[model samples]
Target: MAPLSDPAPRLARAAEAPALAALVERAYAPWVAVIGRRPAPMQDDYTARISAGQTWVVAVDGALAGAAVIEERPDCLWLDNVAVDPAHHGGGLGRALLRFVGREALRRGLPQVGLITNEKMARNIALYQRLGFEEVERREEHGFRRVEFRIAAAHLAG
Candidate 1:
């Protein structure tokens, strides 16, 4: 396949739920062993998220390659999940989706964007930190040790 050229994410359509769900599974499958369970996104109801207009998808060479699930909270845009197909890993799709979150937060007039990840996923925690997200806290939630991160939307201004 040709190299991806800064793939842009778009709102996920309800019909794409199954494909998006599969993509998320493929993306997060590796973490199951590390976290000792399926990460939350692996079991998410993409159809419901799509119906809520909270799902965004990225395609590479015309195939679904990544997705982001976000919720507009009162104070910030909560980035519930971001997943890139393992086949598409390290191709900047993850960064693109993350940058989209900042713009999305700004568009909605939110001051910040926040996300949480399993504390055991050290790689992900470092990646988020490298991408300008600041760790806000660490706590056990829903049977998992979670680390929360946030970045001011203004910090991502381009």
Candidate 2:
């Protein structure tokens, strides 16, 4: 475990689906028990996401260290998922990935970036808030209590 350098995020290729899935699963494993079920990202269609070019892979020294699934919406960029390998935690990879999403949203002319997380993920919620995301609402969906957060593009400009 060499300390991670700045992670370089690039579009994920179809061939890298398994690696992406593995990274996401490993990153979200601790939350499974808290959530009382497998998190949605663990069951995502990685092949489709990769083929759609909606998945980004962040590599540290050529090793997969994190990933984000971003979907372009008419009004905003939807950050469907973001995960950093537990081995690479505390290295700022998650924050870097989020900054990448904000940049992408601005680059695409979207007004904001939005995402949802399990309500039980208090640490994640706090992290998002620390990064300027505001909690907009909480609701039950797919048997999960989800907390939604949003960060307008204007906020990212500062």
Candidate 3:
């Protein structure tokens, strides 16, 4: 793809619930198997409720290749989830979507953007680090160790 750092207008709205769920499934399935349970909404029942912040997507040739869920709760800007189509993994879509989050956070003057990922997923953690997120907290839940990472607004802008 050409430079994905540039925002593509209204591209995410085209990704309706079903397609976004499918992409989420492909992205989360391996984690489900490794962690012994689905992380967020499972297939057939997944709803894309990314209203509080924004949903950003990456497309190639008009196809839904990846997506991200950014929610701004009363507390902080939350990067709830990010997933690229399994078929399009490692193609810069994930990084592009993450850049979108940083830009959005900087745009809104939010203090930071945070998210949780399974601790066992080392590669995901590394990716988050490369994207400017720092591990801020950790907790064990339902037999899974979850690590929370936050990227400061200054970091996003820098």
Candidate 4:
């Protein structure tokens, strides 16, 4: 199959919740065995997330390809989840979404963007570091060992 072009990210509509949920499942499926259980994103409530306006999706050829779920925190935009369809991995969609998160933080007048990932996802940690996210801490949260990262919104400004 031909590679799809990365499209601009946009707020996900309520109708896209099902598709987004599926995308999250496909994106996080690989980590299930590594984590010894289903990843948190897999069990998320996408319908509520969409209604809350915290879900953003990237579509290619009118199909959902990637998504980022973010909440506006007092100090920064908290990225709750970022998912790229496994088929789209390594195509730069994930990077584009991270950039979008940074832009969203700037738009919201927040100083930074923050996120957490399972410590078992070594590649994700490296990718975040490469993109300028600084590790803030690591601790157990909700029965999972999580690594938190933050990036100044200024670093992501165009």
Candidate 2 residue spans exceeding 4 A from truth: 1-5
Candidate 2's displacement at residue 24, Å, is: 0.8
Off by over 4 Å in 3: 1-11, 41-53
Better of 2 and 4 by TM-score: 4
Candidate 2 lDDT score at position 98: 81
Candidate 3 per-residue C-alpha lDDT over 13-90 given as tens digits, one digit per residue, 9 for 90 to 100? 533667777778878888887767887534333343634325667766776677777777665678777788888876
Q: Give TM per candidate.
A: 0.94, 0.93, 0.81, 0.94
Question: lDDT: which candidate is best?
Answer: 4
lDDT of each: 0.88, 0.87, 0.71, 0.89
Q: Taking the tens digit of each residue's C-alpha lDDT, what string does model 1 give over 1-158?
A: 43443666789998899999999989999999999999999999999999999999887766799898999999999999998899988777788778788888999999999999999999999988877889999999999999999999867533
Query: How far is 81's C-alpha from truth in model 2 (Å)?
Result: 0.4
Lowest lDDT 10-mer window, candidate 4? 1-10
Candidate 4 has a TM-score of: 0.94
Mark the 10 consecutive residues where model 3 has the least summed lDDT. Answer: 44-53
Please give the RMSD to the true structure for each candidate, in Å: 1.9, 2.3, 2.9, 2.3
Query: By lDDT, highest first, what's the ranking?
Result: 4, 1, 2, 3
